[model samples]
Target: MPVLNPDIARAFDEIADLLEIEDANPFRVRAYRTAARLVLGLSSDLKTMVEAGEDLTELPGIGEDLAKKIIEIVTTGHCSFLEKLEKQTPPALTELLKVPGLGPKRVKALWHELDVETVDQLTRAAREGRIRSVPGFGEKTEARILEALQAQIAAVPRFPIAVAAPYAAALVRYLQNVPGVRRVVVAGSFRRGRDTVGDLDILATVAADSPIMERFTAYEDVAEVFSQGTTRATVILRNKLQVDLRAVDESAYGAALHYFTGSKSHNIAIRRMGQDMGLKVNEYGLFRGKERIAGDTEESVYAAVGLPYIEPELRENRGEIQAARAGHLPKLVAMGDLRGDLHAHSKASDGHHSMRDMAAAARAAGLEYLAITEHSRHLTIAHGLDPVRLRRQMDEIDALNTELDGITLLKGIEVDILEDGSLDLPDSILSDLELVVAAVHYRFDLPRGKQTARILKAMDSPHFTILAHPSGRLIGSREPMDVDMPRIIRHARERGCFLEINAQPERLDLVDIHARTAKEEGVLLAVNSDAHSIHDFDNLRFGLQQAQRGWLEMKDVLNTRTLKELRPLLAATMSR
Candidate 1:
């Protein structure tokens, strides 16, 4: 019955959605939405703080009323306000908001006009050509809705890596503390460092008498126990994340881990190699005619098949086996390799922290330099900087750099790439900064050719250093913009510009495949924590995960180089 941060956030988000659909006050709806974001972004556990009798109102955007609501939900596992809102409006209407082009207004229209309550109902209306009859919804909008519905139906729900980490780490810690438990490891996509995971596959080794299954099924977060056996248990957490736990003997531990931490194709390929060698491979062990051979360690399993142990992130059967055979597996980039982050924001823009606070946090994170890339003037909602303001900020950074120790601030702007591909700020202003992190802030639905051209043209700018979040994807919520990434990578290579592997959980842009493609094309990537707050510097880990999955080595990363070595490379991007 624990009310986790995500749980509270979801409640507030739902309340906001329902209220918006009901035509509630805009300020009230916005307050709930902002509260949800503040709760979700908190680094500490609200439940633990609540149990410790800490004041929840200390959290930004959480007023006295919201603080009481947080305490109530943590104590009772429900929020009365959200429950009442759900009663007033069909909760399913919130699902309509998830459709790509449908906003709260569109959802309200559909609900009030056609009585559409679910995706199925919406689909029916779309198919019957009835959605077009709704005011503000035309044939094109209806068609787009149908397309989005089909995509949603075909998609499997995935938890963002950041969202899943806490649950997985807590479970591992819990099991590790159990009596007679020898080892516990989270496997599957999590172990592979995937950007999103469907579920958790946990493996543990314990003494013969250990009551591991019972302990797992009794965990406080367990919403339902699907099945339980002496050595295995399957349960769904209150957050709807499914977890499967298996206890294996020490002898089969590595094999079991390998089997479960699989890209199924990778396992099949290894099993096929085992077959070629007159051996059988499975979760239990690698056997040569039932005379158990390698199973105690992952190295032994791979050695039995004449290959070195491949890193989990690269175990996708995507040339990994071949690379392993040829002794060519990459020394993937590690978190320690980064020297600086080139994309960040502060109170000068949409960011919550001051420039000094963000720099100090970066220094604490072992970074020697960090860029302060506030948004340019076009992003008015973020209070983006005009040329004069940017100049003033540049002077401030210069003063801070002289006063600070151990860290340096690089002046930069996340200059919006206009629809026609021009930088938001004039070159006269851009020339003053250390770097320019160009990005697309709007026009997400441009045709593939147009989008590609738009980005390509932006890169031609003398000051354009890195292409931030090249695809502009927001994980499950927003599909990546249509653009030719391969062409973009090639252009970057020719222009000596770099692309960013933005570390934000929502937009782990320049995803695994694209990162790898860039590496192969000889274009370096900056795995940047596009941090808006000091806590956001920790997001670099997720970025590193994405880079690792892309087969990136330290040399393939632009930010891994020391400042002495990096400045020259960055200078190459500027026009003479």
Candidate 2:
């Protein structure tokens, strides 16, 4: 089996987690965590590079020691260091670290003091009122742990789109290279642009003698082949992602794609329409009383039912069919529609790249403008800038704007929204920047009313332009804050401020439903990369996916406007 980048990254992360739990050297633990992030963020395939004899140590944050481990995992699919660490610390203890309020120190306390090794053990202790007696855990913390444990138990495992992308793209590319294979498309939530996917449903059309199923089952990343047939196969990747592949002939390709690219409710609704038209629609083909009609093209499939082609992102059965019938479906915003990204960071903060490098990358990505929104001073862990440092960065941006050719850098700060709903920086400093992206980096467990009111109060400030990662969610890791989203959207509408659909895969906040709500409330949304490094710009595609699912039109996205148009809109948010 081939070790993918994510597979290696997971191993490194697990090692870091176990090390931290063991109270090992802080720097050593950080090195492993950083190495894991570096691996995960690379745009290229680490395993392929290792196979090709590339110097793995040349990669940032990867030392000679880590490089050897990378080669070990790539060559043998296991790391001895991680294996040893798992033996020293219970591997299940890592799950306890995922509980919201449980940090490494607290997890250590639970392990040594309470003998809690897993979430179940921790939950049992918490329920028995034993957790509160631990060193740092109070009654409130125990209750929160119990609640988090229950929520985790009830939630289905879903992979973030970014985590699934490498596997999907690799599989598609691999299948496309197979002799006689005509088309390979990943359907299901992935194609529909959902933030998280349960699994990949891959559809392909190939010649009868293609042996596609056999090829798929033999792929380097396949950990196990659940089943295999001439036309269909199910396999799990090494990273634990299940992929189901189905092959059809060209005649049924479109119908098969439509059937597989489904929101189940949407498919049921469309099939009902087919029944009304005296026809039947399925993976085979569309038929009218035993006579094959349309199935060669998705457009033809829609036309057979007297409807226009609906974009897959809009096929959520959320008034999409009705909108299509009325010809009111939005012209969804595409990747090229974005003119700039408004949230990013640089070396002055916790970002890995320099400002100029980030700007050059944005330009390379075809963006006309980019904002450097470094964290404000309150976020000291990021070495966030004070007013003095911020002013200096602003000057740097101004100078670079003059020297740069195509891309212009905007001066901005991701100011923290304090516990009392106040801005982190003074208006005197904030007013000097091109944009003020307010975020809630702390106090995530605030009650819904308080959190909503806190955000609204921050928006009341004259300088607040956008709400960064409006929900503060980290996919499977963190739950979305309990704020009332509709109220926040309405407030943004009234305040003339914008909400962010953060592109970071882990925090695809202002998710599809909230983005749609903002659009319906006549509020524009900004789909920003929130990039900390050049590679992070790629995250914008995920943000675009979320926006597309929200039925966002080009006009509904704030950053899609030219710099001239965007300037006045952002300025308008500050006038009040």
Candidate 3:
């Protein structure tokens, strides 16, 4: 036996897998999902509770019986129930669970009738007009499947938000280094922290007489040039990624920045404002009464319009222009105000560092504290463990906590919320943990009502503290699971669950508009890095920028709390 600890959430996923197979009770399923999420966020071990024979009811949604199961897994490698469930179902179905709009029902249909079991097999069937014959599937649905397949093939692989973040930084780096380029920067949805960016947008200023355009087209990275012009260049680099670089004279830089760094709606509003002011706006320069005033930097452009510079998150034309004009712009949160980090990973699961190393890195970066939110049992591919491992990890965390002088390390699990609304682990294991970050993993396309009920049920647990990246959007890769955002925000507020502003470039799930709406509705937020490596810390600044654009403040975030204060918040949430 593998000595599974009841507290280790790694096995929670196995239970979720079992539930998906049995098509278990949605709310009960979400309990396991919640447990998985809660465990990843907590600093404690399930084995400790198992050893103490504790009840999971204190952890929320977890009763004494379920807690016993968690202990069973920790001391033994397998649970009899999960093992029995697995015997009746092919584990391979789990791999097919992620296709958009395709749920377990559809997967079962293709499996039982068509004997299709893989993406390639599904693709072939769709191409051959076989999928429509499956019950509940139509010609249109098959066509949609083919389209998604082709899109999947033609599209860039899903780069985690963390991976894409650096490309923007790299582009900026080059622009800053280029001669005559004085104010090079990244602008557009990427600047605003949209989950995915189309092509890179860079804005810069140069002396009117400078050969910046010529220098750019001939730059070392240039491979196949799409277009070469005086103001902009569109080129496909050796890596096959398209990059659009735009240049402007110093006098027109500011207006151009505002124009290019647009969510389109914000730009239209600005243009209207400019027209009212006897001016015009474009990616070139601002024309005011046929003559331009200040247009070199973003600062001058917003200032000219009688407004503070708008953050990128608010640049989506979502009342930001009116707010700026009315002088009702909410005070934006700053990067400096963030005092802690709420999510991170380590070698204990799929992360790259040790617990001590991750904590030390957080401390070195001047963070007040951080959470060691590793993957729970449901993420077996990521090496999610059972309760025994979770308990041992807690011991390591406790020891490290004592070693730190000022920085406090938190126990947190990035638990997987099963399709049925249950969490990955049992309740007995959850009550003693500090933080729970409930997340969605499988069955993303359930009916909206079902999905909503699923998450809401997870939140019923007092142990549930934060809703982590609720939408599960991987920018440029997938759309958010269908759910009513307003209602979701409202629920979080009522339940005291903090909505996350995930700092991953691709998964800045709660951007300004969402964050602002959340803030306006009294939702507490914690801007988290979801950092998997030490270098991922840089992504925090960008995430915070988007949070500021949402008009969040230090007080709205959990990471801003000192350890002493944060402990109470966690305690209170558990008690609730």
- Best-fitting candidate, scored by TM-score: 1
Q: Highest lDDT: give the candidate number.
A: 1
- How would you encode candidate 3's per-residue C-alpha lDDT over 378-497 as one tens digit per residue? 988667756778777777889888888877888778888887788887766666678888788777778889888888888887679888887877654468888777888998888877
Tens-digit per-residue lDDT, 479-546, candidate 1: 89999999999999999999999998889888999999999999999999998777788889999999
Over the full model, what C-alpha lDDT does candidate 1 score relative to the true structure?
0.91
| Candidate 2 per-residue lDDT over residues 85-165, each given as its tens digit | 988889999988888788889988898999999888988998899999987889998898899889889877889888898
Q: For candidate 3, give the lDDT.
A: 0.73
Name the runs in model 2 displaced over 4 angstroms.
25-31, 51-68, 123-133, 138-144
Each model's TM-score? Answer: 0.96, 0.95, 0.72
Q: After aligning candidate 3 to the native by TM-score, how far in Å is the CA of 418 from where it should be? A: 3.3
Model 3 segments more than 4 A misplaced = 1-144, 147-168, 175-179, 280-288
Could you tell me which residue pairs clash in candidate 1? none
Off by over 4 Å in 1: 23-35, 53-67
Ranking by TM-score: 1, 2, 3
Clashing pairs in 2: none
CA-lDDT, candidates in order: 0.91, 0.90, 0.73
Cα RMSD to the true fold for all candidates: 1.8, 2.0, 12.9
Worst 10-residue lDDT window, candidate 3: 1-10
What C-alpha lDDT, on a 0 to 100 scale, does residue 85 get in candidate 2? 90
Q: How many backbone clashes are present in model 1?
A: 0
Superior by TM-score: candidate 1 or candidate 3: 1
